[model samples]
Target: MKDAAFGALLAIQFLTRLPVPLACPWTPATRRWAARAYPLVGLLVGTLVAIAGSLLQGLLPPPLLALALLSLWVALTGGLHLDGLMDLADALGSNTPLERRWAIMKDAQVGSFAVLALVFHLAWKGALLWALLAAGASPWWLVPVIVLGRLGAVGLLVAVPAARGEGLAHAWQQSLTRRDLVLAAVIPLALSAWVPGGAWLALGLAAFIIVYGLAVRRAFGGINGDIVGAAIEGGELWLLLIAWSWWSFAMA
Candidate 1:
């Protein structure tokens, strides 16, 4: 459990750029638990964003508040996932073959497609979050959704093959055993029980996993860090959009 906790914290540090100190030592054994640990990082990221959004609620206008929280959320993770989303977008927009697309992603320079994709993603996220706030969904609800989305991404890492020859995805490609999935599944499942209508949230997460798995299989030929990152962003954005839409309709 301690090792798992440390792995979780390490993941949080990796994902969010958090300044927490290392509580446990790193080891080869730690790598085995990486899949389980990754989502906990999302949990922390979501919690922080919700807190920021909640605090900013009274001070800023709805759109600005959402944008502020969204910026903080991306900055926390160093926009790591967003970067993936942009690269993937650029690759997809290209007319080249798969190998060529992968090569393009490796290029350090951002292309026009990447720039436009980043703008759209950030704009979409900002608008979605702003709508959620205006709809009066509790900030508490947002945190679990974030956790679910990230956990869903990790699940994808376990379920899919690596698209490239080597990278972070390759490291954990087959390393995630059954025990790892169990541990990864349990934490979020337990947390979901605590939120209002949380079971439905879990159901939504399941749907996301299914859809993401199919998409990854068809699109990337396998899962990579970029796809996982895109999955995380997609999960979060979709959940917020769902919540906002549901709440708005309920009020109407």
Candidate 2:
């Protein structure tokens, strides 16, 4: 139980900007333990966003509330996933050799493709979220969606080879295991069971795994932390889009 609690704390520490007052001896085993708790990190973020949205929904227009939530969302994770998305965009858009593309991803400067990707991503997410709010959809779905998004990272980290021999992915890959993957998936699966139209969540996650596997293999040769981050962003968007589409059809 103590290890589980620390593992959860370590996950929160690594995955978000949230203050976790506990510290544990950082080791490969520690990282492995924390990796299993990745979905819980998403759960915490989603819960916070849901509570905030519910509290403020009546005080502001849907668009404004969405904007506020979006801002909070980015702040919570310090744009970590978005940064990965941008890095992947820049690498893929460069159309260079694998070596050069890897260099491009490592470059700290933002590229044109990254800018466009971020703009489109934020615009789409904001618009869809606004629509959901306007439709009076329960905020409960966000928790599972967010959890599933991070669970996407867990899948890729386990299923794909690392792109580089060093860095966060390499470190994490050392600790990643089939058991960790199953542990990471459990919460999202349970949460999805309780929501209406939750099959979309499973569909979206399955689609992301297939699509991301093919695309990343072609584009980067393998997965890394950035690809994991990109996968999370894409996965979340996939879930939101699926849910939005389902809501549209039901209303029609």
Winning model by lDDT: 2
Model 1, 78-186: lDDT tens digits are 9888888888888888978888988887788899998998888788888878787887776667777777877887778777778877987777665676677778778
lDDT tens per residue, model 2, 1-252: 666777778888877999877767677777777888899899999999999988997899989998998888889988989999999999999988999999999999999999999999999999988888787786666888888888888888888888778888888888878898988878778888777777778878988898888889887878888888889888988888888887778765
How do the predictions measure up, each by TM-score? 0.90, 0.95
Q: How far is 67's C-alpha from truth in model 1 (Å)?
A: 1.4
Query: Which lDDT values do the candidates have, in the order given?
Result: 0.77, 0.85
Worst 10 residues of 1 by lDDT: 24-33
Query: Could you tell me how far off, in angstroms, the CA of residue 103 lies in candidate 2 after the best superposition?
Result: 0.5
User: Against the true structure, candidate 2 has what lDDT?
Assistant: 0.85
lDDT against true structure, model 1? 0.77
Q: Which pairs of residues have clashing backbones in candidate 1?
A: none
